[model samples]
Target chain A: MRCIIRLTLLEMLKKKILYLTLALTAIFLIFYGIAMNYGYDSLRDAEPLMRIAVSGQFLSMGIYALGFIVSFLSIFASVGSISSEIEQGNYDAILSKPISRYEVVVGRYIGILLVLIPYATFFYLSIIGLNLYFGDGVVANIVTVNILKSLSVLYLLPTLLTSVGLLLSTYLSTMGAGVTLVILYFCGMVGGILEQIGHFITGEAKVVLTSIGITTSLVIPSDIVYRKASSILYTTSSGMNFSADNMLGASIQPSGLMLFYIGFYIIIMVVLSIRKFQIRDL
Target chain B: MMLETYNLTKQFNGKGGFKDVSLSVREGEVFSFLGKNGAGKSTFIRTLLGILYPTSGMGLMLGKPIGDVETRKKIGYLPELFQYHTWLTGYELLYNHGLLYKMKKNEIKARIDEVLKIVGLEGHEHKKIKQYSKGMKQRIGLGSAILSDPLLLFLDEPTSALDPLGRKQVRDIIFKLKNEGKTIFLNTHLLSEVELVSDRVAILDKGEMKKIGTMKELLHSPLMLSVGNCSEKIINELKKIDPLLERVGNDIKMSVERDNDLPKIADSVVKNDGLLYMMKRKENVLEELFINTVGEEDVR
Candidate 1:
């Protein structure tokens, strides 16, 4: 199992995409830093409350982009982890060894997480670092100790993606798994928007839209995790749910029950992946 | 017995896989499975190795039931379509396989050197598999299969893609491993290979076992004689030995059940004034057996 984990990590490190992603990440951080510096300077004369609102909104956008990149990376990296190996006949030699099928699925999951966790940490801190380094007095004030709590929630985004991605990988072809996961991810994102819109409106439309959002979250809780993270960050700092005014913000904080459900969702996905792989013919 | 299967069956939707096949391979013996494409030869191997679950029946490898994790520790397999992670170097691939077999790191390190030399890839160990040729990739795969010095090795079409030289190299390796008292279950459609290396051979046609026996029991080498001055007396005398003796242009072809009949055949031909120009047993008797067992139309 350790060998499998090592091999998976080595394969990811050796991939050209990892380097491309890092290069692109460096470019993104640079642009983000420059934007924060210039945007802070432009708001120098703004009133105090206006500065806090604008900086919080700007920081929310940066975190949203960060989560978006990590979510896609997690999905694409793992969607083919099992299915492609099967398609290419790579598992024949490996699986015939003394290791159990459960180890293969779990080892790969750990291997992917081993790479993704540190990466998410670095990217998360970099965005916060840029926000702090280029952040004027207003930006610093809004990023409170609650940022730590929010970062933990942000980590769930990739965890949720990888678990579901691996589950789909066990059942579907690489293309089929990838397409389905991406479509589900899009559904989650659009559902979040509908929920946010539903929060602002009233009557039957509100109930219907919010129900759709909650339903998609039940299918895949990725977007809800992101919203929950955002809510933790902005609401704790500003003493207000800024998403009500800011479009990118979390309008309704995902409940504690949703967090428990996400944990349950991940376990089921991992368990199902192992069970499916064990019973299926490679 | 190193490997045994009793009525082991694996089919996809009740089709295209072996059915009710039972065989046992003894220690230090080379067992060959002969079949055409999609004959369930590979499927049977995979089932025994626990890569594919058997739909019915049972199998044992090294006395443990198939799919038993500990049983796999003593087994090695080179898949018919061998594809390793191309990103790994040859040494890395072997080391990882050894790790999967639960070999100590130091032991795996020591074995990698010997395995590389055995597979004729010593200098190429550090080269990535993607950089290696098809033959080199094959050698690396063979190297991985033999890395743990397994008690039983399963080689499926082990030499299908090699050049003549590469094939001979693999055959030599098989000989070396056999000499060390290792059990080898070889799956191949190559009749010549089966004839050379197998102690016992089984022919599978259309997912059914058509023939199974020792090499001598399966192949009947016929005698082809070039006779000079053949006359009715000589022909009539030879008919006693081979009633179906065929004569075409001074050449006679007939099946001899035993080598003891050779001398009597020579004396009968000579005494009857039929000069014996040449007398030798026919070649490729396995090909004839295979074709007869499985119809020639399905030959691959």
Candidate 2:
């Protein structure tokens, strides 16, 4: 397993995928940096609420953009963890060694996470830096401890999505896993939005959206956790009287229980992928 | 025994796997599986390596049940057309392989140089595998396989992508390994390789073992006699000396227990009004035995 991790990291570096990802992230940050500056400049003459509101909008967009980039990286990185190696007939030589199959799967997961975690942290911190600069030092009003909480919760979203991609990889082909993950991503996003706003819609529309949300949540709850993380970032005791569950300033926050559930989800994905990969013939 | 299997069967939904194979390979011999593509050679090796579960029966390698990690420590396998991590340099790949075998860092580093030398890859260690040609990739693959200096080696078509000289060089290495008291299980349809190095060979066809024996035992030395027969008298006379003598057109083929019988058969044919055009010993090559054993099907 150590060998696998070491070799995988070496491969990523040699292929320049790590550097490429970071470079792509830098470009994204540059664009975000420019947009944040312009958005803040426009809000200079606006009312304080409207300024905070636009700044908040920029902050949310920054978070979502970072989230999307991380999600894309995680999915593409993990979707081929086992299936591609098996397809190319490379696993036979490696798996024939004294190492257990579980080690390979878990080690691969660690290798990918090792690359992604630093990527996530760098990008997440960059966005926070932007938030501090463009939001007129608005986030400074929030406690540093609360900022840490929000950062951690925000980072966990990518980790959860990565686990989902890995879980799908153990059974599906690379393309199949990627497609399924996209579907699941949209499901979580739509389900989070519709279910949170189901109260305004009357008649059967409410019933249909609620059913979709319930089913998607039961199956894959990563998007809901992401929304919960957004709420954690902006919502406070002195915040607006927002009834919107999907909003960052919403009153309905995800409980601590869901954090543990995401933890459980990671463990279950790792275990299931290992179990399926153990008996898989290459 | 270095490896043994008793009625081992590994069928994928009752197709495309070996069946009821019972064979024992002693230590320090170059044992080979001679078969064409889709002939179950790779399947059998995969099963023995614990890559695939046997549908029935059992196997043991180095006195432990198949797939035993401890037992695998003494075994090295070079799979067919092995596709390595192309982004890795040859040195890094060998180093990683040594780590997989749980070798100490210093020991792995020390052995990597020697392995690279043995595989004739001394100067190319820093080159990425993507830059390697087919033969270079194959040699690097072999280098990793033997990095731990295993007691038993399994090579599937080890020389498939190699040139003629590369094939000979690798073959010499196999011989050297055998001289070092290492047991090797080689799988290939290359009859010449089997003829030169294999102490024992197993012929597999359509997921079944057709024959298994030592090189000499498999290749029956037959005397070929081409003649123009004047009567059935020569045929009856030849049958008296060997009941299994076969008549192929104007030629007769019969296994000779001794060279003295050849003279007697020629005298009988000449005295019995038979015109003996030629009298010579056949090549008794592995190709003949392979053809005879598997028959001429899609052994390709």
Candidate whose lDDT is highest: 1
* Alpha-carbon local distance difference test for all models: 0.89, 0.83
Q: What is model 2's C-alpha RMSD? A: 4.3
Model 1 clash pairs are none
- For model 1, what TM-score is found for chain B? 0.91
Candidate 2 ranges with C-alpha deviation above 4 Å? A137-140, A199-208, A236-251, B223-281
CAPRI verdict (incorrect, acceptable, medium, high) for model 1 = medium
lDDT of candidate 1 over A167-218, digit per residue (tens): 9999999999999999999999988889889989999999999999999999
DockQ of each: 0.76, 0.57
The digit string of per-residue lDDT tens for model 1 on B223-245 reads 99999998888888889999998
Write down the worst ten-residue block by lDDT for model 2 chain A. A241-250
Please report how far candidate 1 places residue B91 from its true position, in Å: 1.4
